[model samples]
Target: MKHSGSLLIVDDNPDILIAARLLLKQHYQSVKTTDNPFDIAGIINEQRKLEQPIDVILLDMNFTQDSISGKEGFYWLKKIIEQDANIVVLLMTAYGDIQLAVDAIKAGASDFIAKPWQNEQLLGAVTAAFSHAKDKQQVGKLTRQKQGLNQALNTPNFEFLGQSNAMQQVFSTIEKAAQTDANILITGESGTGKELTAHAIHQASMRHSQTFMSLDMGAVAQNLFESELFGHKKGAFTDAKADHIGKFELAQGGSLFLDELGNLPLEHQAKLLAALQNRQITPVGSSKAVDIDIRLICATNDNLDQAVSEGRFRQDLLYRINTVEIRLPALRERSDGIPLLANYYLKHFAQKYKRSLTISDDDMSALCQYAWPGNVRELAHAIERAVILTEGDKLDISSVVGNSASVSTDEKTQSTEVLNNVAQYDTFDLDILEQRTVRAALKHHQGNVSHAAKALGLTRGAMYRRLEKYGL
Candidate 1:
């Protein structure tokens, strides 16, 4: 037999209670009813103590009055929601009081039905209410599960560890945006924790129960990007022997995080734009367009406006994807955050490596002075390295100070060389100098494209073109 959950119906009329019991008995394992509104809470509490709590409440409006006004029921609804926000309460209102029903919904009712409701309509509404309640329960269960798993996996703590005014504004903005279903575009320098911000938004949203899937657009190969995103039919390509579901399909009713979104190819951008505009997608080799419900959160380190002006990115697509834009400050720009982030990473790595280490004032000063071109990611790695290299509880700053001194020497030498070379010419070309500086940084990083690109303050694609132009 199918397992039918319990339900409680509250109304003052004995005939109405009997009718509700009969109507709901076919679907629920137990249909408890009360003709006295005063005893409703006691009955619910007693049943809950018995470990068979009500799954749904069919609350009648205007229990004491014959008139159709829902004033009395509204107060009961508010009480129920305040007492147990998890309980699903469906209002029973007259046809003329639909506006009142909507008001009840805003006050926290799961749904409402009118008097003289048809059997099919009533059943449908109740079924929908049950489904929503179950979904919420499932999400709560999953959150607990994730928390346990994270504990076991020993993931790093993710509090927004920053005290800068810019960071404060960012936090405030995120708090305001978390209450709605707006698509957010996060722009920042590389390693500035854009993905972390996306995770925070998902954690704060109503749909946090659903899965969160992230894809790095820059990492995906151009030829495979479409198949990777939209899935593929059996025999869609040479490698596809079976059907594959895309990220969009997997993130249905959840979130799809597109990191480095500006790196998406122009052709793929058009397809993505269509999906965002229509909430539907077609697979690589399929003619059928599958409907999807997803909240898109995109991040990019590149200047999207410049890409749009260069005709490499679509302007309309940008507008559609960026309903809300959040800019994350670079670590160097938010200098005040350095000490906090450094200490956070220190404690984190110390626990991971089973060491107890402390930073001296000199070490702290050295960290705050350096320009972190690699942002938080680099800082985290540096702290991990230091933790491993140090022998005692106190970290030594000699290595860090020496590295800084070497970098300074290299910069001064390069500056003098640039001045000497430029002074030989009557006219200095800014573009040529910029290209040379980009080339030198690429060489210094030993062709590690991403690091060199960051050092030159250029996107990877832009860096690649400069590398080719200078034949480096």
Candidate 2:
């Protein structure tokens, strides 16, 4: 799979830098490295020219044997954050100055790792930081899109564009909720514009002038959940060479929108509840708590009530984060909004790619009829693909909608064969069937052993050997 972001590792120790680079190179296509923190800004400028933009920074607090206080790294962290608040910075902290890491977070570090860190922990931190950075970037992109749409319409300002009763009620609720400090919970299926709803509430609220930060809970790993949400101190572990800050700290005096909140592990939910109740959070390895002044806005696709009934989510956490709840209807549910959203995306993409395209009535009808399982995201991607593949100004729905018949036929045939085989073997042992299933999945994913193993509930090595056994 292609990674969506790049990372930059800065450390004075050549060995540490090399190790970090080696570890991240497999996951990220672009992993830049530098031993001197002073060269960071220049390197960032150079890397921006590359096809893929750098998304995260890992900085070591202490530079060399002589500079013990990590003041240089601390200054660089401030400068880098000032230059680009979007980049996620993970501080490398040493064992003795963990307090310094907490201070560094207050100064602007995204998260931190301790010295002598486990490989899994380091990887987890990087992944979490990069994921958070990507979410922030998407929020910024959406804000710009809304602004551009307003400019195109010559409107006084951008507001949610819908006249339906459902949307009118949503607007009214948002306006009323914006005046209070209560945590608001927004729920809907994917691509129902939950993030947009969050942004609208933020813009309409008393904290409009303050920074707005959003995070996707579904993207981060289970192990690093604590460090990513609460942050960690320097030397808190082996990889901690500097101090770091958590999301709660960064969202101080602002609104923290936790998107896809239902995806968070049950273990992390309790901690989050405590933070919401106390209005403060302590770094993962630190004992002291930092005060935070911000409103919480959480969104999720899954039903938290169902999750709690199933014991997969904590009811207490849900109660804490959802003082006010709003549910956005899916595109199909709001059929009247389909043409509006389609026109919005159509014009947006046309201008973005410098084309004069118009959506015919026939094309609009097809878009409305099609089941958008992936919601607005799928719709946007479909429009972009259609625009790129199209030779003329008008979009042809035949080419843009659904897979080719030949490809669909092949998939149907394969699925039927798999089902038939399982049915024929009435006495089949489930364990053996599972092993065979793993091998087949590996072959289907083009030998992506890890993904295949995950899908089949088997270890990667076990899946690899099964493939060999089946001569796949």
Best by TM-score: 1
RMSD of each: 18.3, 18.7
Candidate 1: where are CA atoms >4 Å away? 1-159, 401-472
Q: What TM-scores do the predictions have? A: 0.56, 0.55
Give the CA lDDT, 0 to 100, for residue 463 in model 1: 67
**Per-residue lDDT of 81-185 in model 2, one digit per residue for the tens?**
776667889888664366877887788887778887788999898888988998987776566445433422332222356666788888999999998988999
lDDT of 2 at 115: 81
lDDT of 1 at 42: 78
Q: Judged by lDDT, which candidate is best?
A: 1
What is the number of residue pairs that collide in model 1?
0
Residue 51 in model 1: lDDT: 51
